[model samples]
Target chain A: MSKEWIGKTSNKVKNTVDRLLVKRFAESIGDLHPIFVDETYGEKSKYGVNIAPPTFPRVFDYGVLEGVDLPMKGLIHGEETYQYERPLLVGEEVYCYTIIQDYYERKGKSGDMGFVVIKRVGEDAKGNIIFTEIQNVIITEAVRKGINV
Target chain B: MKTMTEFKPGETLKVTLAPVSRLDLIKYAGASGDFNPIHTIDEEAKKAGLPGIIAHGMWTMGNLGKLFTPFLEKGFIKEYKVRFAGMVFLDDVLTLKAELAETSGNDLFFNVKAVKEKGQEVVKGSVHFRLYDAV
Candidate 1:
């Protein structure tokens, strides 16, 4: 029953940075830039092709953590980050996966709270990193108890 | 919001958005593939012991990028990190701000934040951008 939850990585999940996904994401955040939607403008622009927004990669599948189970409900997204080597070009293929970077518990106002730091990476076909994200989630006492963590 | 080399360390950019709505969360969920009920259904949120449906933390963080939208031609966001200080409920009007923290060659550091109408800082952190054409 030892829950050593660091460095647990997921299998790579392949995804395409398509136009529709990028457009929806751009519009959803209410930051619809021409580079994310208008093809004509994008073609004439610096990149010569439509490019996804900086934060668009948040939508890609980063696979799942193996042998770790936690309640999805009652968990708070405490912090998040996105570090990009470059923006993912539209229609480009990316492989993503997640790693449990660290896990610990702390005393909070409501009681015991658990902090889970997960690092998700997106790489190109050559295995070069395009971006990496570290997501910090706050799990409630009940969630910790449920998982016996 | 100065472009190119005109940006200085103390320069700042601000964008005040409309109130957060149920549809905003719903749209964000669909676009981001995060279907957690606590973000969309009020009943589900109550069952989860929340006041009501809360906005996804990423939703608010994503909107913070708006402060740099006009300056894209000059650079791109190389890093964005933030802590969710408070929950975002419906009808919360968020004010996004970015102040150039420093400059190093082509890289520009910015202290970014989002504040609720009531003056609560919901999200706060820094962003790093690399200019395409730098001096």
Candidate 2:
């Protein structure tokens, strides 16, 4: 595989947070926190409205992968990290962009493998970043065989 | 686990998560747009040489996030990171074992890890958070 994806960035994608989206995400993870799903509970909370789960931003569209095409079939999610400025609020709009932060190769028990690190940053309309998520993806040779030519 | 204000170093907060089911995986796939066959498709997972359908890494992470939701509601979590140490299969009972590593003024740092009933480590990470003093 070519190491040409380093530093590549995607176009900005817009996403809106709402009660249904927030509730569904919380339910999906079986986290039925009242702050996320109960309207009355949220109305009295400090955030003034229902809030999204901490990982709700994962559902945000970070545009398309502009670079680093790989056979995703065998891809492995190696790790993930998130830094938050504040908990995301329901009914807020956030714009996000994805970037290929780094790429490297190493030998593993399965043979040679490549690791790609991608980052996505979400910001409010005023351009203040609300949160950033970094994910590490591993691609193995066996998985590469499934890639379409 | 007691309130964050009373948290002490060497103290541990233990939480047993609900068993992760195939339906949960499907719901997560629909909500998160992950849709990875390794997470939702049994035959595709077998073809990939996996034991069976595995839960999405973020699903485990989100479960971990639940542990701190209370703290987040009262205080604030500045950062959270995790390394996917092992796979979580269907019907796995995950336990979150978190220990406070240190405390500096209002900042509390802790090391958190998740494991199955059989003691297989699934996720390991650390969290840094700040507590708000009541007025």
Candidate 3:
């Protein structure tokens, strides 16, 4: 993995937080939290409406970066972390983008592997950051082997 | 499940999810844009020396993340972090247990973990969140 990819930014993705989409995201995780599901419960709560889960941004479709491309076939999600400025509320349109934060290689018990650290940020219409996620992925030769197998 | 007002320091909450199935893996693949064969194709996984289709680490992390949902308001989580402690295979039943680590005025912190049958730990981390006053 070339560290040159570090600092490369991906295309931006925009989305309006739809209640149904939030519901679907929660359903996918089998989490039926009242604030994410029950409208009446939401009305009585602080936000006064449904909200998406912290990890819901995982569903945002961020197409591949223009100049930074890693082997897509054999990538493994190694670790993930998230920090939030505020909750992603239902009905607020959000814009998100990703950057290759860092890159490196290490030899592990499995074999030689490449690591790519990606930082994804989401901001509201006014440009106030709503959340940020840092995801690290590992690329292995076995990924290519599995494809041919 | 513990509420912001009701949760006391040192208390533990347990959340058990539905078994991780092939369908769940597929849906997650579609939803997360992580279509790695290791999570969806059995032959590829076996070729890679995996038992079969293994669940995504993020899926297990998401399972652990859900435990804090009921206790705090939306977007109140200041920070969340998790490490992939182990692999989860198809049909593995995951149990998540979270314990309150500390609490301040309106901030709540918890230590959470996900485990499979026989107490094999899969994921473990801490979540720091802020509580909002209910009107």
Best by DockQ: 1
Per-residue lDDT tens digits for candidate 1, residues A3-94, read 38788899999999989999999999998888778899888878788888777888888887778786777678888899998877888999
- The TM-score that candidate 3 achieves is 0.88
Error of 2 at A19 (Å): 1.3
Off by over 4 Å in 3: A141-149, B133-135
Q: Model 2: per-residue lDDT, tens digit, A10-76?
A: 8898899978878889988878889888999889998888888778888888888764576657788
Ranking by TM-score: 1, 2, 3
Q: After TM-score superposition, what is the CA distance of residue A119 in candidate 3 from its true location, in Å?
A: 0.4
Model 1 RMSD in angstroms: 1.4
Give one digit per residue, the lDDT tens place, for model 2 in B1-135. Answer: 578888889988778978889899999999888888889889999998998999998998888878788766677777888999999999899998778999998888989999999999999998887777751
lDDT of 3 by residue, A93-139 (tens): 89888899988878888877777899998888788888989988887
Best by lDDT: 1
Q: What's each prediction's TM-score?
A: 0.96, 0.94, 0.88
Q: Report the candidate with higher lDDT, 1 versus 2.
A: 1
Interface RMSD of each candidate, angstroms, one decimal: 1.1, 1.1, 1.5
- Which digits, one per residue and each the tens of the lDDT, describe model 1 over residues B5-113? 7888888888898999999999999999999999999899999888999888898888998777766666788999899999899999999999998999999999999
Model 3: fraction of the reference interface contacts it also forms: 0.63
DockQ of each: 0.79, 0.77, 0.65
